[model samples]
Target: MGIKSALSKPFASFVVKKINKWKYHAVEAQQKVFKTLISSAQDTAFGKDHHFSTIKNYEDFKKQVPVVDYEGLRKYIDRVVEGEENVLWKGKPLYFAKTSGTTSGVKYIPISKESMPEHIKAARNALLTYIHETGRADFVDGKMIFLQGSPEMDKKGGIYFGRLSGIVAHHVPGYLQKNRLPGYDTNCIEDWETKVDAIVEETIHEDMRLISGIPPWCQMYFDRLSAKAGGKKIKDIFQNFNLFVYGGVNYEPYRAKIEETIGRRVDSIETYPASEGFIAYQDSQTEKGLLLLADAGIFYEFIPTEEYFNESPTRLSLGEIELDKNYAIVLNTSAGLWGYSIGDTVKFISKNPYKILVTGRIKHYISAFGEHVIGEEVEYALLTVAKEEGLEVTEFTVAPQVNPEEGELPYHEWFVEFVKAPADMEEFRLKVDQQLQKKNIYYSDLIEGKVLQPLKISMLQPHAFINMMKAEGKLGGQNKVPRLTNDRDLADKLQKYLL
Candidate 1:
């Protein structure tokens, strides 16, 4: 056996044992993690203010600390930025992970020393679990290319700042670094298009076995590789390629396109890593949802999505969550975020193993006229219609058309970029509208009462979404097209590219 395969076998076995232990005692593990986190931060400024010394249990913790978002924690983050020690955590953070924000220009999330290991460990366990479950250790015998953000970091106030992918890339294990592709010089290229070209030139002839990245950007890489190799499928170029690791966005929309590009069915593993923390991962090949990392250096709480926007909402711990109910995730991590709302909504699919599927973002919805349609509902409708019509959607977004001066009632406008357009546009539009109405009753009522007209479709030319992302300087890595918006900010920008 190859060196990597030999090493991975024992490592995979070790990961399986830990995963099984966590699975069987999920609640206990979560409680212990919470206690450990509380004790660790009890002496920090935030902890002292919230009286963490007297906080005895989950009930006391919740009652003392209010659920907060980025804006709510900006004061503490600002202090950290200003080089204040023990402002949030026990000491200054190692770095700040810069991510896109809703109201703020950019969010700088703290990554403390204690919490950084959880990110690396969770990622390692995810791959090891996949290998253990599927007996796919041979995948380690060849090179793996992770299309990540530039690894070169910018120092801000004595702390490094960059995208999470960039930060993680800089910390890849020395052993695996030997098997990674696209040398550091190429990876540090900031312009995505330039970086992709460099990557293609560097890896086109290598024995590449794995590819991992956000779906859309990976698709771009595959497309470029195909063009360079004379329209050859990825499998043809990398004959031993066995796995595709993806995250950052749902894979359903990109599955058909990716498989078509590869020319064969390949195994895929999904993860739920964010700037806030590493949340969950696909632990079992047979399971539909990602297993929650209950014992990681993060404490999790859930608020029902419907109640989240309320002035006061109920917070449910891991032990109290029920299956199939959408909840907004609140995290208190070792990174020093205290009861912070991550803004994403998730639904538990299995309570026994504690597996979850991210449903949508709390602020990423359309309720301009009280219709209240979420990203999940819209994605479901689009995927359903596309599947029935045998079409492949590249990217899409929805926005509200609320101007009566345009001579039509307010309605949801869908801007779609299709890799394979349906033969009949009218049929596609009608099916999408019907499915959405079925998914959301409020949307149905508006259409029925003529408060809103039928949803409108503005077909975008091929690569329009990619071009738009490029123009906005968010072309690659974890960035994605916001699936739904309350206003026309994105829609108006994309309308200029309609076919």
Candidate 2:
């Protein structure tokens, strides 16, 4: 409980051994999972209209089951609401996990009992690995807090769709279920404020150690808790909390301020979870990237990064996957999605297929100046520069901005909100510019031409980024305001508040 002695070198090596062992088995285990998937998918009740039958071999499955995005599932999603029991699964879905849709609006994604266990197992595995890394699993006496979205169920008592947090909430061990936030699995998401407040009020006394949620919401809770505590820092309310588990988007943007506010270097865990599956987790104490859930109840597929924009991408099976290659991740889930590209790209960090670094979202890239900068790329570059320059940046947003001079290339405009003022922004901007170029060759070329001018620093009032998101109806409940936007919509809306 006393920080576990900083995870020594020998202990770190032991943890690495466990990781390698798990990964080695993961490759072989995935084949068995694939075999089971292939067999079950062939059943008329399981496949046919649901698209699982399309998978024969891994290659055949890739060809038959075309990459499906959020838009592709719209029609079938309506079928789910109509109570078509097997539309998105083998049997009746236990609940519908609501996730935000781009054009279709809020969508209720059906969660099958078969896939639910996978979520639970992956989550537990993540926790176990963290414990292994820190050698502190034995000391976890405090309650594990999960800040999830609404858990409203429908006419048949199935969960209404919203966010992954709510969907995964049901998977929390039944033994610990009673100890969670008030009405955690049954309350309306609209009442999140009330529920969260009640949870804070109740748990303020308990030794709540591990807290997990999206950064903004957790920050909101911390802010409110701090205010309620009459300017007491975050440490007072959750006095025992040391580990912060966050997902949904990049954590680097808010890392510095969050640590400062909490008054400690908190152990932060990153997760790559989609409605399709709990894809990966950062198992190592070093916290570089996530280890993919290769043996989860999903058959994985990957398309080379070069093929991402192709009309018909040539897919690669798990067997063919190579390390250090960027691939757009696709999933063939037990819940009936086949060859579904979840729109995220990952680069293998090790030869082990199970470990990867989430590079970026497939569609969430900006290439206006021929610099193919994705969300993760920009995030890494910005974080690296900030760390090097010792700048205390809390939040930032980047968009493609065009300079109106004839024949000039469009450039990136960075909207940075720093917590502490940097003494020399000129040197900091130069460092950032260097990092940007180093990250991607095209971005560097653009910078050299003055196409993308110096990085812009915009000082914002306290909690400015979050407040603006709330004002735009893009905050609260399940909505996560994006840290990086490809277009200028968010930037345009937020320009008035910029310094």
Candidate 3:
């Protein structure tokens, strides 16, 4: 056995044990984190302004700090961007994770020294958890690739600024450095297609075991690899490639396409990593959801998603959250983000260890007809129907069609790119629409009331979603097409690609 592979078993066991110790004491871990964050930043500008020193409990925190998005925190962030120390956190942040914004042009999320390690650790522990559970460590000796952004960074007020993935690229542990691919120069390639091509060429002959990336981007890589190998499955090219590590989005929708490309089912670990923090990881193959990172550098709060936009929404802490309810996640991180709303919604799936399913995005939903369709509902509806109909979908998105022909009422339009045409497209659409109605009561009510017609499916041409993303310059590196959109912007732009 290889030296690295031999040692991986013992190391994985140790890490898993340590993680379990914290997971079992999850409530206390979160409580300690909350207190530490408050006490550590008590003298900072934001802390003083919010009267942090006077705060004694979660109730005091609620009174002192209003839950806010980037816009609400922009004033302090602006000061920090100008190199102001002790503005938000204890000192100037170590890095700024730059991401595209909805209202704002671009956002620089702070990443402090204390908080950065959690990002790396969470990723490592995810793999360790897999190893400990499966007793498989041989993959550690094989090359692994993480499809991600350029590792290039530009200076911003003496704080390194780039994509979160790019910033994280710098912190990969030395031990895995030898087993990682593609080389530095290839990873630095700006264009995603070019990068994928380079990666295929660089790693095609190598012994690759693990592939990690957001699912869509990973699919793109798989496609390119297949093409390069004369339509051979991915496993044919890399026999040892057994594990797939992915984050940013759910892998279920892409599972069929990915496994098809690879020629076999492979083990995968789902993770929930955001620029704000590494939130969770799939700890067991048998588990239904990602294990929530209660002991990480983040103290989590959740507002029932329905009430997220309401005036004075109730913010419930980690210990207070219940199972099966969608909650808009709020963060108070060691990075000095206090009462920060990161826009993602999660539903607790497990209680004691606090495992969660990322249900949807707070900003990415369709409520045009007040039916309030979310990502999870749409995905569930479509996937369930697709499974029943024996259809494979490449990618899809949903938007409300507000206006129709003179006699026609409006309906939710699903733009689907199926792997092949279904035998009865109308039948498939009907089943999916019915499934959607089953998932969302409000949507069902709308259809039943004749306020809206049953949802319609608009089959898309091959690579339609990819082309759209490429056109928008969001082809790779944590960019995901929203499953649901309130406006017709994406849906309208997607019109030209329709079948």
Candidate 4:
């Protein structure tokens, strides 16, 4: 074994043990983080404005500071961009993670010096947790590749600003520097197509082991690798490539096709990360959920998904959250975001040693006909039936088809790209429709009442979604196709790609 591999096993054990202690004391850990954040930022300008010094509890916090999105905090963020000190957090932010939002356009989320390490630590622990549980530290010796944005940045008010993935690229640990592939110049390529080509060239002949990225982009990389080898599977190209690490989107929808490309299934890790914080990671190889990072420099509050927009939604702390119920997650972080709604929804799967599964995004859903179908439901429905049909799906999105040409009822249109299609297209559509009905009773009711017809599947050409993302200038680096849309905007644009 290499020096790094030989050394990581013991370090993994130590980190795992420390994580275990914090996991079990999760509620207490979160409470402590809450107190520390409130105490430390109490003297900042925002703290003074919100009476943070006098706030003693969650109740006081709820009453004093209202929930806000990026636009809601625009004034304070403007000050930060102008190099104002102590405007929100204790001092000037270390960096700004620039991201494009659906409704808010570009956003610059502050990452404090204190909060930056938490992002690094959480990502490191995900791998360490895998090593500790499965005793698989051998891959540490092989070249590792994380497909991410360019490390290039533009400074705003003396703060380095770029995509979150790009910003984190600057901090990859020194030990792994020798093992990480697709060098700085390759990563700095602007066009994603050119960049991914460079990534393939750099790592195609290396002893690559772990490949990490959002699923769709990983799929793109795999496609290039497969083509370069004249149809040889990815496993044949990189025998040591046994682990896939993904976040930002559910992997299940693309799993069948991705594994098909690999010619075998590999162990994978799921993570919950955002511009706001690194929230959780898959901690157990045997378990089903990502362990919540209660000690990760962020305090979490959850509002029931059904009541999220209520004038006073019930906000539950870590100790008060229940199992299997969807909630819109809110963050109060040391990065200067307070009572912030990150727009993602999640469901707790385990309590004491808290663990969660991301259910869907709060805004990304199809409720045009009062049949509110979420990203999770559609994914579950399609994948479940696709498994039965022995088919492989590439990517898909659902949007309401509100107006038919004439004398036709509106329906949910699923634009799907497939690697292997089932024999009977109509039958496959029926099964998927039935599965979705089973998962969502409201959708079932709509079908039965004739308010809407059954869902229709629009088969898309290969690379349809990729082409669409390219046209929208969101081809890579944490950008993903929205799984569900209430409007026809994306659906209409996607129609040209349908077969």
Candidate 5:
């Protein structure tokens, strides 16, 4: 082994131990940061434009600044883009992190010059946690590949002002700049084909040790690697890739497939990254859930799911939040967003105020014939069925499809890709359908034929559905298959590719 590689194991271990030891301090630090932020929001920023600037306590804060969703912030963001003072940041922003939001078409979140420290620090904390756990500063001495968004953008003064990918590509650590994947600075937002080609070409030569991106995008890279290897097993591309870091969405849907495609059990880390902030991350060793970054310049509030969307959500301070309770996340960030609803949900795994499990997207839900189904419900159902049937499910997605010709109401149709096909798929499907119905009372009533017919299942050709997503311009870098589609148009599109 090379000198760097030789020292990696011991270094990585030391880092992990050190981080775990400092967990308490991290939590205390977060408490101080949150206290300061809430004070700042109340005293200076909140409602400064209007005359209502006396939000002192928690209740006052809640009442004064009504829980603002992304839609609520959209108008203000437009003004921010147009240089409206006091709307976004205090002064001129260094750059805008252009991101495609889930519900919003697209948005340019004005990242402040002052708040960049928070971003860098949070990201560095993430690295430090990994390093403290692993004890290796140069664990990734080899090339680092970022499978990110568009590289090409409008250039002024020979400088590119693209998207988030462009910003990171331009400002990445100098020594690691050349280590990034090709077209990291190119505008991936324009031509999908060209972006995919660039990604394919970039990774074809180097040996990648560390890679970061969302699941679908990483899958695209692995697929390209598979093709480039001339049908060589995925490990042939790079058995050396010891670490894989991913965020942006749930990994449960894509976990098994990624493992199969890569031909090895890779070390994976999960992160909670949004335009608001990088919220949490998972330990590479545990691989169970994420460790909430309390030191990341934000105060987190958890509102019980039962009380969510009500007249008032019962908010729990970070110290009081519990394990295993579903809560809609609320944030007060250094980015100048106060009591901003991030449109995501999470459950606590531990009470130390640092670890939690990502439940699902707030908007991503599957309601088949008036039965509301969320990500946690579906994920648990699948996990239970997979365990009971002794089946290894590789990847899956569910959508509600209404088939008028078949005289069927909108029912949940599951696309399952299995590692090994069960001896009796009919039996498997029947059990899954029954289990799903039992878990969801509304679906149970539908299965009883009074409301709707039994749930449907389609076993897809290996990677066929993912390829279909690619064919639809939804599978390049950072693009993902809709795990749960409620829209009729998207459901219809997915139905055509069903096997």
Candidate 6:
């Protein structure tokens, strides 16, 4: 056995034992988390307003606190931003994770000192769980390249602000730091392209064994690395590379391209992490979905996606969740976010282990012609069509073509950037349309009733999506092409760069 594997064996066994126990004790674990959260913040302003002192159990807590989105918590957050103490949590937040906003400027999510450890622990446990399950602890023996946001934070009103990845980069453990790349100076570079160049120069010949990042940016890194190494496959340059830890966006569409770039198969582990919290991770290799982090300092609630927009919606706890139902996730975290809606939709695929698949975003869907098509449906259709046609798609986005000039009926418009275009583009488009209709009955009915036109396909030139993101100043980590939009805004913008 390798030295890394030998050293990690005992810890890996411990992690495996803990995870095995967690599955059976998920309910008790979550209940304890909820109780601790309530007690921790009972003296805060939000807790008082929500009658936290009077709440005794889950039912009482639910009855007292209403489900709210970011906007609903804006007032409290604004106060916290002005350096108010104990406004949301027990004390001031150590930093604020700045994320893309909803139709506004930006969102500042509070990260408390008490909650930071939970975030760090969950992330560490994800890798540990993967190692335990896969028995591949030697992954830690070599360099693990993390393609992330700049570590350099900006201070505003006495609060540090930066991407969650950037913030986490600052806290990487000392032992792991010794095996990580690119260097600190390279990570601190502000521009995406320039930073990528620096990373290539710094780690071109290092003993890289693992890579973790958003799918699109990782693809960019692979392509650049290949180009720099005289067009050789990535595995040729980093022979020890054996694992890919990916998250932040769907990986299905990019899988073929990534595999082709690497020139060989590698074990992949997916995570469901957001700025609010590290929620889930791939625990078992045999499992098809992520194991919900019930024990991880975050209490989860599921609201039926359709009912989420209703005047009143039913919120179901982890025990009440049913398999295969789409739910808009609401979280009450140790970070002092009480009953807050994070806006992402997910569906439970397994119950015993409590595994879930992220379905879509709450605000991200196409409902323009009475046809409610979601991100999951679109992605499934696109991926299915690509696989059937032996095509490779780099990126894609969909929006409704509501204004079709004169008298034409409205249709779903797809802007796709293909690394390998299909031999029969028309056939590929028809298959995608058919697959989408199969996935969504409402879309099929609209097409059958002649209420909507056939799906329109527009192929984008190489680098178009990247250029669009760059122009909008969101070209790197965690920023992805909004898959399905309700309006023509994204489609119209991409049309300017159509091939």
For 400-478, candidate 5 gives per-residue lDDT tens digits of 7666456556567777767677788777767777777777787787768666655667777776666677677666555
Worst 10 residues of 2 by lDDT: 1-10
lDDT of 1 by residue, 334-371 (tens): 89999999889999999788999988899899999887
Models 1 onward score TM values of: 0.97, 0.87, 0.99, 0.98, 0.85, 0.97
Q: After superposition, how far is residue 275 of candidate 2 from its true place, in Å?
A: 1.9
Expressed as tens digits, the lDDT of each residue in 319-340 for candidate 4 is 9999998999999998999989
Model 2 bad stretches (over 4 Å): 1-22, 44-46, 49-55, 156-162, 182-196, 403-409, 449-451
- Candidate 5's displacement at residue 233, Å, is 1.9
Task: Locate the minimum summed-lDDT window of 10 residues in model 4.
Answer: 98-107
As a whole number from 0 to 100, the lDDT of residue 313 in candidate 1 is: 99
Clashes of each: 0, 3, 0, 0, 24, 0
> What would the per-residue lDDT of candidate 3 be over residues 1-499, giving only the tens digit for each residue?
6999889889998888899888978989998998999999999999999999999999999999999999999999999999999999998999999998879889999999999999999999999989899988889999999998888999888888998988999999999999999989999999999999999999999999999999999999999999999999998999999999998888999999899999999999998989999999999998799999998889999999889999999999988988999999999999989899999999999887889999889989999978888999999999997887777889999998899889999999899999976898788888888898999999999999999998888989999999999999888877898999998999999999998
Model 3 / residue 148 / CA error / Å: 0.6
Error of 5 at 270 (Å): 1.0
After superposing candidate 6, which stretches have Cα over 4 Å from the reference? none
Tell me the deviation in Å of residue 145 in model 3: 0.3
Q: Please, what are the lDDT tens digits per residue for candidate 6 over residues 1-499? A: 5676677767878977887787777888888888899998999999999888898988898898889988888899889888888888988899999987755468899998877887787778888887877778878888899999888898866989898999999889887888999988999898999988889888888989999999899989999999999999998999989999999788898899999999998889898888888898887677799889888788999999889888879989899988998999999987778889998999999888789998889899999877778999999999997887788999999999888878899888899999999888888888899999999999999999999988988999999999999988888877888899998778778878899
Judged by lDDT against the true structure, how good is candidate 3?
Answer: 0.92
lDDT of 2 at 401: 76
